[model samples]
Target: MPKTEKSSMSWLLRVIPWNTTVVLFALAVTAVLLLGVHYYMEGLISIGTLFLIYQYTQMLNDPIEMLGDQVQEFQKAKSGMLRSRELLSMRSEIEEGKEEQLPQGPLGLEFSQVHFSYNPDKPVLQDINFTIKPGERLGIIGRTGSGKSSLSRVLLRLYNLDRGTIRVGGTDITELSLQALYRRVGMVTQDVQLFDGTLRDNLTLFNSDVSDHMIKETTDRLGLSQWIDSQPQGLDTYLAAGGASLSAGEAQLFALTRVFLTEPSLVILDEPSSRLDAATEGMLQSAIDQLMKQSTGVIIAHRLATLEKVDRIMVLGDGKVLEFGAREELASNPASHYARLLITGREEELA
Candidate 1:
C-alpha cells in the first residue's frame, strides 16, 4: 500500500471506535432521561426517585469513558506486541560460518561468478567477478541500482549469495566466523551514527582501552584537530544523539576516524562524501587518502573525480562488470566508459 493510504487507514482505525463509543454513550443517556420522565409522569415514580436515577446515570459516565480509553490502549498494545513478536521470530538468512579466524595483515579480496537477488526471479548481482590484490585500491563506479552498494553488502556477509564464492586472503569468506570477518573488513557509509554521550565516548565507542593520546593522534591525522580544539570541553564535550549537533562533513569525518582506529585489513568507502559540499569533500578526500595508504580500499563513488587517486577502476552496469582495468589505461582510451564519462563530465549521471 502507498504510505499516504496506510496513514489514512491507521487514522480511521484509531478514531472510529472512539467516535462510536461517544455517540453510543450519548444515545444511552438520552434514552434513560426520556424513560425516567415517562415513569415520573405516569405516577410510577416520585420526582425525588427520578432525580436519584438521573444522578446514578451521570455517575456511570466516568467508568464508561474510562473503559473506552482502556480498550483503545489495549488495541495499541496488542498491535505493538504482534509486530515485536514477528521481528523476534525471524531468523537471519545467512548462516553462521565456522568459528575460524581470518588471516592477519593486508587481505586480498576476490569474487567469482557471484549471483544474488532479493527476489528469486529478479537478480541484483549476476555473475559478478573481480579481484583486488593486497594493499591495492579499486574504484567502483555505476549508476544507481547498478549494485555498487550491493558489492559491499555481500562482502560484509549482510546477505548470502545465491551462487558462487567470495574469498579474502585466499580463504572463502564463508569459512570465517562473522566476528573474524567484520574485524578484518571495515566500511564507512554516508550515514554516520552518533550516540548521546561525550565526544570521547563516541570516538572510542566507550572503550577505555583506547588512550586519549591515540585518539588525539588519529583525529590530527584526519584533519579533525582544529574541530576538536573548537569544542569547549575537547573530547569531554557532549553531543546530542544521532549527530544532531554536528554538520554532515563532521559526521563523515567521525565515521572515518572510527575506521582508522580499527585498522582493518580492507576498507570500503561507499560514497561517504556524497552529501557534502565541495570544500568539505576536499577535506574528507585528504583523510580518505591517508586511510587508503594503510589498507586495501574499495571506493564506490558516483563522482568520477573521487576515483582519481585509486589505482584501478571498475565500471558496473546492470550488476555486471562492463570495464575493469588500470585507471590510467582506461582514462587514455577514448572508447572506454571511464574515458567517456570524464570527457563528457557526466560521471555523476552515468554512475
Candidate 2:
C-alpha cells in the first residue's frame, strides 16, 4: 500500500469509537425518518445492522486500546531497565595511556565519502571527507542541528552512515572492536552524569584493581581534591544521585578526573561547559586544557571563542562543510558565513 493510505487506515483504526451510544443514536434518528424515506422508495432499513456494527467496533476498540496500553507499558519498562543498567554500568574500569602506534606517529583520523540521515532523502551529512593528523586539536562549529551530533556519531559508529569509510589510527574503525574504539577515545558532554557511589567510585568508575594513588593524582590535578576533602568520608563519601551532593563545578571536576584517569588517545567534548556558570566553566576549561596537552582532540562548541586557540576550525551549515581552514584564515575572511556567524556570536557574547 501507499504510505499515505496505510497511515490513514492506521489512524482511523486507532481513532474510531466502538460504543453502543453512538450506534443507538444513529438508529433512533434513522427510525424517525424511516416513514418518509420508505414511502419515497422501497423499504430496506433495520436497527440490527447498527447493533452488529457497534458490537464489532467494541471488539476492535477493546484490544486496540489494550495493545496501545501494553506498548506504553513496554516502553516504560525498557526505560526503567536502562536506568538501572547505567547504575550498574562502569564509566571507566581501566588505567590510562596508550603508546603511539609508532614512535611519534600520526594518530590520524579520516572520514571518506560519507552520507547519513535519520530518514531517507533527508540526509544530514553529505559525501563528507576530512582528515585530522594525530595530536591535532580541531574545533568543529556548526549551526544548531547542522549534523554536528551526527558527525560525532559517525565517528563513533553509533549508526552506520548510508555510505562511507572511517579510519582511526590508520585502521578502519569497522575492523576494530568497540572496546578498543572506546579505549582509544573519551568524551564529555554538556551534562556530567555521576553514579550513586563514592567520590573515588565515580573517579575510578569502581575499578577495585586500580591504585588509589593514581585516582588521587588525577583528582588532585583536576582540583577535585578539595571537593573530596570537604566530604566527610573524603574519597569514600557517597555521591548523591546525579552528584547532587556536590556543586556543579565540583561534579564537573569529578568528570574531568574520570576522563583523565583513562587518558584516551582522542578526546571529544561536546559543549562540556554549556550549562555551567563563568567560574565553573573557567575551572573546567583549565582542567580540559591540561587534559588535552598531548592528545588528539575534537571540541564542538557554539561559541567561537571557546575554540579560539585550537589548531583548525571547520564550520558546517545545512549538512555541508561550509568553511574549514586555519582559525586565522577564517577570522580574516568575513565573507564566509562561518566567519560572519562567528563575528556575530562573538558580538552577542560581548553584549
Candidate 3:
C-alpha cells in the first residue's frame, strides 16, 4: 500500500527462493540415496554415481530458479516504479522547482500582454495585462479552463510567460534566483499534499523553529482547536498517508494553517472550500480571513461569496484579463463579461 513497503516486497520477491526447485532437489536426492542403497546390497551401483547425479541436478536447477526469482521481482516492481518515475518527470507547475535565496517577494507582479499554450499551435491564454501592487489583495475567477489556476502559476513563476514581463521586487523574474523567489512565496492548492508524518511535522514541515504558539494561534482562530484538542497527542497526532486519515474539510483547514505558518510575502490559495458544506465553508472563511489580513494574496475563487472580500477581482477568459476593478463595480454592471458570468455561476449555485 505504501511505496517503501511495496518496494521492499519487490526486492524480497526477487531474492526469495523459487521453492519448487528446493523441493524437487530434496526429492531427487532422497530417491537417489534409496536406489543407491538398493544397488549396493545388490552390487549394481557405487556411491560416486549417486553423488554425481545429485550435484548435477542441483547445478542446473539453482541457476534456473534464481533467474525465475529475478523475473518475479521485476514483474512485481513494474507498476510502482512507473508511477514514481512519471511523477518525477511530469511537467512541473509553472516553472521548475529551483532554489532561490531572496528575502521578500510578491514584490509586485505585472502581466504585460502575455500568452501561453499547453500545446503548440493551440493557446489557452491570450494577451493578458494586470499589475498587482506589493501587498495588494486580488482574486481571480473564471470558468474551468478559463485559466484561473494558470494565472496563479504565472504569478508564482510556475511557468514563464511567452510575452510580457513578470517582475518581482522590481526585477524581472527571469533574472531572479528561482529558489530565492519561491522561499518568500507559499501556496495552498485545491489539491492539498500532506506528508505521512505527525500533524506537527506536516504543519511545520520539520522547520522545528516554528513556535507552538503560532500553530496553536492559527488553529484556535480557525476553529481547528476543537479537533486538535480531541486528539490524544495534540499537535503530535499522526497524519495518515495521503491525508486519508483526515476529513476533507479538516485537511483543507490544515493546509491553510501550513500556509499561515510559512509567512510568505505572497500567498496563493485555490478555493479549497469550493465543495464544502456551509458550516465547513464558514470555518474555511474564518481561516481565510486571518490568512489575508494585512498580507498579499492571490485567490482563484469560484464562489462569488468567497471573492466578496477581495480588494479587486480580475476576470479571466480565454487566457486574458477581460475585466478588472472593485467587486461592487463589476457586480453593478450587468453587461460586462465578468458580471454576466458571475451572475450566471451564482444562479447555477442557487439552482
Q: Which candidate number would show the highest lDDT if scored against the true structure?
A: 1
lDDT of 1: 0.85
Name the top TM-score candidate: 1
* Candidate 3: residue 279 lDDT (0-100): 74
Total residue pair clashes for candidate 2: 1
Query: Each candidate: RMSD to true structure?
Result: 4.0, 11.7, 6.9
Count of backbone clashes, every candidate in sequence: 2, 1, 10
Error of 3 at 322 (Å): 2.3
Worst 10 residues of 2 by lDDT: 94-103
Candidate 1 lDDT, 57-141, residue by residue in tens = 8898898888888877876776677668979999987786785676677888899999988789889998988899998999998
Q: Each model's C-alpha lDDT?
A: 0.85, 0.70, 0.74
- Window of ten residues with lowest summed lDDT in model 1: 271-280
Q: What is the TM-score of each candidate against the true structure?
A: 0.82, 0.65, 0.72
What candidate 1 gets wrong by more than 4 Å, as runs, is 1-35, 42-45, 194-201, 206-211, 231-248, 272-278, 303-305, 331-335, 339-350
In model 1, residue pairs whose N, Cα or C atoms come closer than 3 Å (at least 3 residues apart or on different chains), thus clashing, are 142-351, 143-351
TM-score sort, best first: 1, 3, 2
> Please, what are the lDDT tens digits per residue for candidate 3 over residues 1-351?
897997787666655555655677678768866777788778776677767766776677767777777777776678568777979999854544333544354455667777877676877788877777887778887667788777777767776676777665566666666776666777888778889889999999989898889889878876778777777788889887788887677777889889888777777888753467777778878888788764677888756666767877887766777789876787788987557766677623311
Tens-digit per-residue lDDT, 254-285, candidate 2: 77678778877787776643456666667777
Error of 3 at 80 (Å): 13
